[model samples]
Target: MTDQPAPTDVPTIRTLVRLAVPAVIVGVVSALVLFALDWIADIVDKGIWTALPKAIGVDPASGWWIFGVLSITGLAVGLVVWLVPGHGGPDSATTELIEPPLKLAVLPSLALVTVLALAGGVSLGPENPIIAINTALLVALVARLWPAVPSQLIVLITAAGTIGALFGTPVAAALVFTGVVAALKTGGALWDRLFLPLVAAAAGSLTMTLLQHPKFTVPMPAYTTTHPIDILSGLIIGVIATLIGLVAVYVFPLVHRLFHSIGNPVIYITLGGMVLGVLGAIGGPITLFKGLSQMSELIQNRATYSSGQLALILVVKLVALVIAASAGFRGGRIFPSVFIGAAVGVLANALVPSVPMAVAVGCAILGVTLVIARDGWIAIFLGVAVTGSIAVLPLLCLVILPTWLMVSRTPEMRITLPAPAKDPQTPSTPASPSPGA
Candidate 1:
């Protein structure tokens, strides 16, 4: 028989179709899951917020109940983590970096998050679970449909889409995802490949908007400042923020160890809740949850609390967050942390009348610093974006630069991914023949 000619290696339209189709399906399904999670979380949070107050004979509307809710939340979260295997969902961001994309069986993670939110009396935000479940579902579906797709690419796409949709801005999501992906060694030509996936994700997000009519919002804070003052304050605030960021980095690991080391995670978590409750009792309910509600309240009525009260709330919230996070409760620390920073900034402004602008600017700077130091720019963007303050941008940017610079100087911050292993029997190393041969 005559030898047959080999097929050309060039990619055909059919090949592209096969590849893109799976990704598109994955993207759409992921978006749907994310939307559903967010919807459900919203409904549940509102219900809990309403019912808890009535059940306990405390007005949910009053700041006093913040402690009660947070204590209960912490206790409940502790119980769930102790009882459930794998505690809650896997660490979404960490897993995305270190692990392969796996199946979407994240009920444990979701359950943990829901319970934590309910028990800890923190803010009811779906951003964390939404990202986890969405990415998990997308990666799982894509892997099943196209087994040949690279796992890292799956992680990148899912991260990009989830972040993009949640933020209501693909650009912001892209910046965060690109930074994360670069860290994960999924860069180079992969950036080129991201274009299609990003577009698909943006489309999916748009679809979500059409169905739900969700509004895209960013905080814009106004501050009065001469050029010299703004520049000088920005520099000073940035340095302070950077130092705060380093403290946060050290704080996280220490807190994580402390909470986890105590006997019986459930007990520890409940105790954490109790601690939060006590703090809340002293600081007012403003110290509870993720601080979204409090943030809104603070922005609207900055004068509601005395400077001392704001300072106390800031301290208590920080402690409560560390306790809740370390005790195996599920949720993102970003919102609560930012809220604490803002509270501190407001207090600083009140205490030092000369630097009235410093309150808003300091909050953004400190919040962004802590975020970048611990979780990177997504946290910074979130802190800045939610403030509804635009005049702080130039100052915020200036502050962020020094914070990044300071963090870069730290040995822990200069993390490098471990290189992949090469085969033992390469051209550089001669292989031995089998004894039988």
Candidate 2:
């Protein structure tokens, strides 16, 4: 009998398990760390938003308390970024989810500012910092413990796991990484590379589910069936929201550069905090935090608000997101964008009750998320996730084609890299002597 040669395309079961086992452990650890971050942020949130307000006899919903807390949060974050060992790591505004891992020493400052931002009602999420911290930590750990594991593999797995843990599902990791991996022209089957990442993501997602993490779903009218009007309205909402989100994207760099030009961390961040505080004061307590709970709150009490009120909430949250992002805060824009998208949907419903709530929301989310995240799958997932209706998913899928057309060739929501700095040690030429001669 002749023994056949092994194929490079298909991985053996032994090889798959060998890689999958450590990935499982990494996923568990990532889930645990994510929980820890959330727990810590919750504790801080209670202290500032609940305990302190009650103890001081100030209403938690009052403008003064909101202003004070956000201002203090800004000041504290500013001090940490200015004096801390790592300058609170890289500015999240300038970094993406898959940027190079940060140093271990930088994680502490990043975590601190992230927690403060979360607790103080800063309009951002933990996605940027937490993902960087987990990826860096896992990469270093695996490099030391498992010498054979490639650093690139570990980074990919860690990222996939973190994304899984974050969204409470492996699908989000898969969708996000799909966009990432599909662009590569590597040899062999695509799943060969995605296999380990998917394994890690599944493990992380299962762990999070076992721990009973909340899923991302909003309360709205269920989508029973798709109609022509549904498609038309969805497209209209998607187009409008995408255009509005583009305005913010266009202004992002201008605002970021404007704040950065202050050239003093404390001053600029403090100023940013003040503006955020003012927004919080105007938008009320519902506008605070990373926007997850606020999104839920908006749904629960949406009936109480007038059309103008809903419009105000949408505008305030949008501006708050821009300020928080531009102000050098250590957080992400995804969750806040979700809130803004929801608000846009709610306002759309208020303006035109003829549109189904579920479809309006799904389309609105698809538009903003498509532009901001630059991933069609994630945007569509979030749109469907918020509606929690499978019927809405198809409508979202249909609306995304045009939404993609709007956002596909558009500028992504990121800062432009600065030019390389000149060396201070270089000697200057004697221009005056030459001119005299």
Candidate 3:
């Protein structure tokens, strides 16, 4: 009999099964971290926006109070970045949703700043910082426990688990990781590669559900029937939202540069907070904070706002998102982008009244999310999620075609800082100074 070589690269079923054990652990731990951070943020948020205002006998919604809280929030976050270890873990505008893990020392500061931002009504979400935190913590812990396991695998599972926790569904993790796994150069069935991540994601999603149920969908009118005209309506809304997102994408770097020119975290971030306070004062409480609860409020009370009012809210929220991200806030853009998309959709319906609200909102969310995340699956997932209707699925699929083309070559809503120019007369210095400095 001729000798044959067993495939060395492909993992055995037994090997994968063993890995699943750690995947489950990673998932559960990741969810616990997410829950803890969110719990802390919620408590602080209530104190700042609800209890303290009541204690002071001031209306929480009053312009001055809103301005004061947001301005103080900026200052608090700014100090963390300037004096806290790890400088709040790099500029958020320079990072992606999934990047290389940060140092362990950085995670606490990142978490603290994220909590402060969320509590202070920053127009951002917890996605970016939380993912970074989970990835760093899990990668280090898993490496310590299982020295043979690859660090990259830990990063992937942690990310999947975190995503699952954030969305309350493993499906989101699956859709998001499809592109990630497809790019792998290994010899195995796609599902085989996905098995561990799916396990982790499922565990994370279930853990989050058991701890606190979160609903991504809103209570909106049902989208029961699909019509030929719905495609056109969806397309128009999607394209318009995409264009608006593009505007933010193009303007992001300029705003980032303007803020960083001050060259001190406390000064620039504090200035950013004051500006956000001004925006909050102008737009009222609805336009403040990470946009999830505010989005629900906006859609639920659509009847109270005119087209012009909706337009003002949309612009104000978009501007706030830009400023918050640019000015050193530790948060993600996805939540606020979703808010902006809902605003566009509601405003369209207010103007025309013929377009169904679900279609309008879903399509707009699909477009805006696609631009911000640069991932079609997340865009579609969030679009359908927001409207809570599969009826909008086909329409979104159709609308995404044109929206993708529009945004495919556009600048992402991130800042790309240039390498520092050297002065021939000056000696070079260390890139990063000590935390005590």
Candidate 4:
């Protein structure tokens, strides 16, 4: 019997180079595409709102009658999704979890999502789609460019690039990608090869940021609380946030089924837009689009929304997100989830009166942690960072431990298993002799 060459004899460096270069290219391209979409969406959002007053003969800067702006935006989103190729929008975490990744479809997928966000009038966010599409594109590009690259390496580079672009920091991106790759069980060796692509993606993201400043820039906050009780508040909020996270997971699958069962994704998506439009009409213009700017406004003007209004917005926004997401619309849940968390925290503060602001911070942290389990630190960073309150980090850290515990306990957390390679030499069962034979 002839012996086949051992797998150990396979070349590794050659494989790594073949995978890393194209992965970087894909990451760079996807980042540029995402940035352009974001810029265009910003222009469209501002332009429509700006024109609303002029068209109706109202003052543009007054910010009153902004409901009209929301409705128009919702209609635009509906139209785009209805006519777009991917129907509803680009692939998201939800989609990635459900469907196999497609490389060449990134651009169209991105376009669909950009349009969906424009129309849905949902206070969602962008990071999810940006990551999903970029990852898929980079992975696809690497496979196409280097047919010899291992599948595992391709997955790592895609993951790294996607994460790198999102944070505009390769280190953080690498951490996120590593965590996700680990969760997906793609293996550890790919991480070593991911270094170059990670660097390239971070550079690409930084370049994009320099060219067109992002509205949501992370800032360091000043910490002030020295009290033990305040530190304890973090633990309390983290527990509460973990509870909310559980609820989000329970609700997500139902939402997914509901939309898919509706038969036609486009119709449901358009309906989702209409529903969002009505919500916008009733809830005010803040209910529309990715809530990046609104989240900033909320943090800056903490008193702008009354406790009751904040609570209402949280519920409405959550529902809108489930609908938009389930109905085939694309966008990230991270930002919307964050907005909900913040609102919940604010409402908790108003109700309890005695709970420190740190408790609310924990609430935000837990809410995001439950929905997104991969990088709990990012959620912690966001909850504290967005508040622009450094005094809360100690409390935020307290919440992180329990929130992690709670998510780790959840049984339904999505886990992606690696595909088993086909065995070419495995003997096929001999077919029965044909009747003619």
Candidate 5:
């Protein structure tokens, strides 16, 4: 492959336009793929949670049903991962939010497992695997159609598009990818560097929005007035939640290893399902799945749950997130972290009515997200999006400083980086050539 000029340094206006058109197409296609995956998962969720239970003559919401469905889901996932062609396309526990594109042959297994986890009541998100799938598929397609386009460029646009689709807005993708683009030393104005990717993200976000209403907003009282107490409460909530997430971060490795000790996907994943089933029985259905709809559900039905009930939900969901992530399930952590933060926010409002509802929720999200994702900007974006109140933005920006300090010195909630691969030609034991042999 030949090295080419950075898109940011393209010579003419026509070139920028040329790059952005394909990017827009990539974004639209990526968002469509995401929508298709979710549509399929939704159908499966109803079959398991509704049709199957009715046929079996059990209450769909019963603990027995939740446990039975989740365990069966786990067994199914375990069997596919163990026997499938590509081992489920890399353990999500070991990968970052975005990694290199997977080989195309691995996409189906990855997609199948991802849908299973979602439909089966697993407490993980689709972000990590979906991003991998889109990146790989897009890279391959672009290479076939326009071989001159660089692989890295396609990767950035595809990722940006998926992120935009996930958050239902181009802004989230922009915030998420800002640090990435800025890091490239190829020198240009940041937005110039951001141009093609942002175009793709906007297209993706628009497509998802047109397909369905975006879920970014929650029905909360408008954050109208601000007092010194608001900042104080927000900071306190942020600090406490960060500390809570840290416990899971530290404990994650031990739990991951314990499940891995089972030594097979069918075994470990099945065991993971059983643990999730028990937790589901304890926490009930609210603690299941990726937690987006559930997050809104908790807020919409806030009056139904006692403060103590909210606290239990928080703890149970936190544990479920850990077990699902550690136990070889194919999913992402961000949505669950958001759910945990939202739960924490609800609890904070119940315990201390003095704090504004939006502020409490935003801060809770900010803190937990900071610890789990270790991305300050994206954390702030989610916090604001949850509350739908820009009034809390400045306060959140201030509190994020302390939250970052808490997260900065801690171990990230990811597996240790794999050891570098040794070159096959490099000798395990260096030997000198026999003298003039």
Candidate 6:
């Protein structure tokens, strides 16, 4: 399959406008699919964490209950990977946020595992799997319907649509796609190339807003003033969180290798789940899941936690995120990293009361996200978005410079497997390990 759209020689505006119709379909359908998957996951989450516990007369918050549930959830997901078709697509730890479209057949199993991870309180998010599912489905459908359209272009529009839906804003899609489009060597007005993808993004974003209106921000105090000391605080917090994230990044491959050594998804994933349960029990309910709602809770109750308590929560969540990602869980790392960043920010504020809450949070998030995603646009966007403040943007923009410097040369949170043995007639290539191997 082609990696990108066939180079265009300045297509007319009319052609671009014509493509907008399909882009809208791509966007709307992607958003609806994302919403449906998330809805199912939420129901399952409530059932396991609430209904089951209540029926059994066990406190969901108890250490034993938390540990037992997570262990079983891991075993259940392991069975899916072991027995399901497509093996739940590729290993998420070895894949980028947006990769080549998967085979259509892999989408269902991939979606199933993703929903299980989300509901099972796995410390990962829906970004990677959902985007892959949308890309595969849309590319197949759009290519068949409009045989003239390049498959690569369909992939771009589909990814843009899902990202818009995931973040509840077309702007996030735009920011992400800018870097992607800039890398292509083509001869056309940049905006001309971007027009269709933006159309899809806007449609997807609007659809998600109408359906759920997902919000990333918490109830943090407003960031109104721009003080000189605030910049220093932002830089310090950003740098520290970036370092913490880098540690996890370096450790990721080792953890992944350790789990893969078990050679059985059932055993390793269960062990990972048990570890998560222990961490959850120690960190309490606030430290579990993908970290979106949990981050909000942490921020709202920042006053209740001392610096020591916040630090413990931060370490636990960061470690939990690493374990979940390394153990073949079918989810993304961005969500949990945001929670880690928030924890760092709140902890910083607790230690030093003078820094603005929003600044600390934004800068810390900016640092941690940059380290994990290695995407400056996304890291900066998340930092600003999570605080719900524009005033912190300038500080984050500055803080990211130093944080990026520190993390730029570090290895990413991904593994590089050994090359597979090839026959004389077959091309030798390396294959990524699937979750639970």
Q: Please, what is the whole-model Cα lDDT of each candidate in the order they appear? A: 0.55, 0.83, 0.88, 0.56, 0.88, 0.87
Deviation in Å, model 2, residue 81 alpha carbon: 0.6
Higher-scoring candidate on TM-score, 2 or 3:
3
Model 4 compared with the native: what TM-score?
A: 0.75
Candidate ranking under TM-score, highest first, comes to 5, 6, 3, 2, 1, 4
Count of steric clashes across candidates, in order: 19, 1, 0, 6, 0, 0
Could you give candidate 4's per-residue lDDT for residues 68-96 as a string of tens digits? 44444445555555665554344352444
Candidate 6 lDDT over 19-88, as tens digits, reads 7898899999999999999999999999999999889898998989888878988887788788889888
Q: Per-residue lDDT tens digits of candidate 3, residues 169-191?
A: 99999898777766554456768
> RMSD, model 2, all Cα superposed?
8.5
lDDT of 4 at 260: 59
Using all chains and alpha carbons, the TM-scores for the candidates as numbered come to 0.76, 0.92, 0.93, 0.75, 0.94, 0.94
Deviation (Å) of 245 in candidate 2 = 0.8
Could you give candidate 1's per-residue lDDT for residues 128-239 as a string of tens digits?
A: 5555666566666665766666544555556556655655556655655555544434223544434545655675566666666553232334555436666665566556
Which candidate wins on TM-score?
5
- Model 5 residue runs over 4 Å out of place are 1-12, 424-437
> Which is the winner by lDDT between candidate 2 and candidate 6?
6
Better of 5 and 6 by TM-score: 5
After superposing candidate 2 on the true structure, give the runs of residues whose Cα lies further than 4 Å from its correct spot.
Answer: 1-13, 419-437
Q: Is candidate 1 or candidate 5 better by TM-score?
A: 5
**What lDDT tens digits, residue by residue, belong to model 5 across residues 170-268?**
999889778776555455566766777789999999999999767878999899777898988999999998998998999999999999998988999
In model 5, how many backbone clashes occur? 0
